[model samples]
Structures are given as structure tokens and as C-alpha cells.
Target: MTELLKPELYAVVGTMSAPLHPSLKGGRCMACGFVFFPPQRYGCEVCGRSGDCLQSIALSGSGTLIASATVHMHSPGARPTKHGVKPLEAPFTIGTIKLDDGPTIRTIIVDANEPSLKPGQRVISKLVEVGSGACSILDLRFAPAL
Candidate 1:
């Protein structure tokens, strides 16, 4: 049987399922309508509200690429690693995506070469697997919208 890919960051990602769109999960402050990625649990940063006023919400997978950069050299050295989750390779593209809903998130640009992306371009979220062999981690990535 194939090993299941676990999320490296559970609070920031949703449960993975086939035929399901991959979206970055966020928290919305019910008190002030403030949306933030990587879901906050303590209190609202905008309105100083605490307790259960923060509700879990799913963000839109489609967004506009506001900023992007190509990494020529990378050293992911001395980073912590969880079981079954391996570090990704270097020289990848990373970009900031402004979701259609509200939040802006930084994500890996899948299959993108240097100088291939620009601001104001449309992109869509995708769930990808990082690492090799039997162990991998499920992660949210972005690609140009078709």
C-alpha cells in the first residue's frame, strides 16, 4: 500500500482528497471579518478579540500572482523535519498569490522557470507531494491558471 502524505502544516492546509481542490485554510475573525492565513487560534490581531470569535475558513484556490522570484541557490540546511516529510529541493520558484477571497499567501510555483511569471498573472492552487521514495509531504503550490 502507498503511504499517505501528511500535511507539514495541518492548520494551514485542509484534508487531502482526490478530485478535491486544494485550498489554503485560514481563520476569519467573526468579530471584524479579518481573514488571515495560517489560522490564528489565540485571538484576533486586528480587533483584539479573543476566544471562539475566530472561525476556520477555506480560502479560494484561484488568485492573482502579485509577486514572484526565482531561486538560483538554496540551502535548506539544519531545518526541522517531521516523520514522512522531507525537505524540497533547491532552485525553485516562489511567489505571492493574492487569493480571490481576501488573503495573500506565499507559495511554491510549480514547474515554473526563471522569468516565466509576472505580476497580475492568474494562478491556481494545486496540491503537490514533496520528498522522494515512500515518504512525502503534501503541500499547497500554485501554477498558472489555464
Candidate 2:
């Protein structure tokens, strides 16, 4: 029998399921309605509410492409572990996407070439598998929305 693989990264992105489509998990201030990605752990930056006032909230992965650029160089050590992840190839396209809700985030653009991307293009979130063996990691990426 095949063993189930545990997620290398959890609580960051949703599973690849029907209703639980891939989305970023962020933090919301229960004291207020402010939301933040990389979920604030200390306290609400807006209202200064700490303790249990912070709650986990799922963020919409769909958004608009705001900007794009090709990275010609990067440090390997700065990259995620090379286990199941693909080797870093320069000139990859990463872009800023403005989530439909309110926040803007940067993500690697998949399923489209850098030259093809344009400002204001719609995109949807997708979870991709990287690395290999037991070190496999799941990463969030965006693609042109159909």
C-alpha cells in the first residue's frame, strides 16, 4: 500500500480537494475585520489585540496580475530545499497579484510565459508539488484565469 505523504507546508495553503480548493491561510483580527497573510501571530497590527483575538482565515486565491518581472539571478541557498524541488533556473517570471478581497501578494506565475503576462490580467491560485522523495513540498502559484 502507498503511504500518504504529509504536507511539508501546512496551514499555509489549502489541500487539493473539491470544496477545499487551494487558497492561502491568513490571519484575521477578531477584534476588528483586518486581514493579513503570513498570519500575524503577535497581535493585531491594526487594533493591537493579542492573545486569542487572532483567528485563522482563508484568503481568496483569485486575483489580478498587477506587475511581472523576470528574475535573472537568485541565490541557491535562499531557495527552498532542493529535495523534491526543481533546480532554480534563471529568468523565471514572478509577479504581484492583487487578491480580489483586498490584499496584494507576489507569486510565481505558472501556465503562462513572462512575455504573455500583462497588468490587470486575472489569475487563479493553484497548489503545485515540488522537491522529491520525503522532502517534497507544496507551493502556491498562480495561473491565468479562464
Candidate 3:
């Protein structure tokens, strides 16, 4: 069975063993109508409402690429990981994406040719394997939608 890399940050559509659609774990203010990503219990930034006013929500993973950049180097030794998590190799790409649901997030972009990517291109959520121990550990990534 596969496992999500960070259950607190995102959720899978179908099942953990075979995730179909990936989405971010977010929050909405019950006091106001503020929606946010990376779910936080702290007071709402919009309404100043406390944790009680926040409700757990799932954010749409689809978005538009605002910008992208590729990292071409890595520090000397292999980076340490918790629980055998595999550190992404250098030359990986990262992108700033604005979700259709109304939040901008910076995250990894896989299966993409960085140089060819253009701003405002549609993107979709993807789960890619990052490690394997007792089970496959999958992490979230964004890719340009064809």
C-alpha cells in the first residue's frame, strides 16, 4: 500500500493505496469566508477569528503556473531524511502556482521541461513516490496540464 508523504498537508481522492486525485489540506474561516492552504489553527488572517472559527477544508489542486525555476545544484553529501524519505535530486524544478480555489503556493513540479514552461499554463496535482520502507511514500507535485 502507498502512503501520502504528509497527510497533514494534503489528501488523496480515491484511497491512500492508490491515490487518484491529490488535493491540499486547507482551512476556511467559519466567522468569515477566508480560505487558506496548509491548514492552520491560528487565528484567521482575514477575520482575526480564533481556531474555533476555522474549519478543515480540501483545496483544489489544479491551478495556473505563475512562475518556475530549476535548481541545478545540490550540496555535497546526501541530505538526511526522516524515516528513509528520499531527498529529491538536484536539477528538480519548482513553481509558484495559484490555485483555482484562490491561493498561491510554491511547490515541486515534476515531469516538466522547465525551460518550456510558460506562466499562466494550467497545472494539476500529482503524487510522486519519494521513498519506500514498509510502504511506498508518495509526495505531492504539480505538472503542466496537457
Candidate 4:
């Protein structure tokens, strides 16, 4: 009937009207020229101006390990559960990666069972899935070069 069609049309429109996820696109400062991943707030902290810049910037995943340490305790953002991801194993290595773009991000180091790791080691970025279904979230992880 007409009533039934109306509801269906609204549903379709609602889905299309949903705001895109921030992680789906890279972000650029609208004030200065600083580009950041996962987007950034307007009004550049560097130039202190707004609406001067506007554009989407992609992040370069290439980077190097600046420091690393092993973690034995589960933290709020570290653990993954049935609904999400849990710590794969105890004493996992977490490292600070310095991107070529001058941004430093902290991430878990995958397959760090080697004898040891050192600073200045080449590393690559990878996406980690946490949770399941609609609640899933993507996390950043790094791995040492072979």
C-alpha cells in the first residue's frame, strides 16, 4: 500500500543520509596545512586560523620504530573480546612508530618473538580488526621488516 511504500522509502533515505565514518577518509587542517589521519579539528594549532585550508589528505603508512616495550597487563584499549579483539598473548610488544610525515603513533608490534628489537628498525602499518558485527573497529598495528 502507499503507507508501506512510504516507510520503505524513508528507510532507504535514512541509510543514505547517514554520516560517513571519520576513518573512511583522511583529514586535513582547515586552518593550516597540517594533514592528519582520522581527521583533525578545524582551526590550525600552528597558524591559529580557520577555513583557510580544506582538503582530504591521505596518510603514508611508512614509518620507523622509535621505541618498543612488552606489555603483560590488559588495558582498556588493548584488549579484544568476543564482541572485540583480546590480547593475543601476554608480554606483547608495543612500539612507538614515527611516520615520515612527522606524526608519532603508538601501536602493537605483531610477531615480536624474535631475540630482540631495536630502535630505527623499519616497520610497516597494518589494520587490526576489533569486535564483530556492526560494533567492529579498526586499530593500527605495526610489524618489523623481515
Q: Give the per-residue Cα lDDT of candidate 4 at 40.
A: 51
TM-score versus the correct structure, for each prediction: 0.80, 0.77, 0.88, 0.61
Instruction: Score residue 32 of candidate 2 by CA lDDT.
Output: 86
- Ranking of candidates on lDDT, top first: 3, 1, 2, 4
Which candidate number has the best lDDT? 3
On lDDT, who's better, 2 or 3?
A: 3
Q: Lowest-scoring 10 consecutive residues by lDDT in candidate 3?
A: 12-21
Please list the residue runs of candidate 4 whose C-alpha ends up more than 4 Å from where it truly belongs after superposition: 1-26, 30-32, 52-54, 75-84, 87-89, 128-138
TM-score of 1: 0.80
The candidate that wins on TM-score is 3
**Which residue pairs collide, candidate 2?**
83-132, 84-130, 84-131, 84-132, 85-131
In model 1, where is the ten-residue run with the lowest total lDDT?
10-19
Candidate 3 per-residue lDDT over residues 1-146, each given as its tens digit:
87877888987773342245587888889988888888888889898997678988778778899999999997778674557688778998999999877789999998888988999999889888888477788888998887
TM-score for candidate 3, please give it: 0.88
Which regions in candidate 1 have their CA more than 4 angstroms from the true location?
A: 1-20, 76-80, 84-86
Q: Give the TM-score of candidate 2.
A: 0.77
lDDT of 2 at 48: 92
- Candidate 1 displacement at residue 135 in angstroms: 4.2
Candidate 1 residue-wise lDDT at 48? 83
lDDT of 4 by residue, 15-59 (tens): 122212111234566555665544554656566555537555444
The C-alpha RMSD of each candidate to the native structure, in angstroms, is 3.7, 3.9, 3.4, 10.9
